[model samples]
Target: MEVRWDIFLIILGSALVTFLPRVLPLMVLSRMELPDWGIRWLNYVPISVMAALVGQELLLHDGQLAPLFTNLELMAAIPTFLVAIMTRSLLGTVVAGMISIMILRYFL
Candidate 1:
């Protein structure tokens, strides 16, 4: 197989554009002490982002807001949410969600 130099350059440039924004902030902030309020607020970012992602998955269908029962993704989320609450294990919750969704997709 022949290597494509043009594609390689595009991938390299794309990666740099993505990587620099993330790395530059960490490098600049490494030695700085953040305010207490800022540290407290940053803690919520992960949960907020996860909630937004889960919301997008459960609530949207074909780029539209789907009705509650009619959404297969939302249906799958029910047991996933339960597993997350009960087990409190990330791996278990993910595996349960995947299995539930695959079964739901096959039947519904």
Candidate 2:
């Protein structure tokens, strides 16, 4: 099949638009020296956001507060948390969570 230049250009432009914001920060910050507090906060931000997102996704529904006992996601998270605390490995946590979810879903 022949390549369409117009379609390629549109895709390329959209790709550039999406990538520029993300690439620009790293490109600009690569040579800049960030303060200690800035670096510390940056390091923690990912973990904090991940925790919030995971908690929200598992426990909340429709932007409202929900109970954990009746929620499958939250129910699955329980085993995941226990394994994570005991094992301290991402792989183990993920596997435990997925398996728990599958078992729960299958039995329910």
For each candidate, what TM-score against the reference?
A: 0.80, 0.81
Instruction: Write model 1 residue lDDT over 1-108, tens digit each, in one string.
Output: 998999999999999999999999999888799999989998999999989987997898879999987788888889999999999999999999999999999998
Positional deviation of residue 36's Cα in model 2 after best superposition, in angstroms:
0.5
Model 2, residue 71: C-alpha shift (Å): 0.4
Query: CA lDDT, every prediction?
Result: 0.93, 0.92
The CA root-mean-square deviation of candidate 1, after full C-alpha superposition on the true structure, stands at 2.6
Residue ranges of candidate 2 with Cα displaced over 4 Å: 1-5, 61-67
lDDT of 2 by residue, 17-105 (tens): 99999999999899899999999989998899999889889877998878766788888888899999999999999999999999999
Worst 10-residue lDDT window, candidate 2 = 64-73
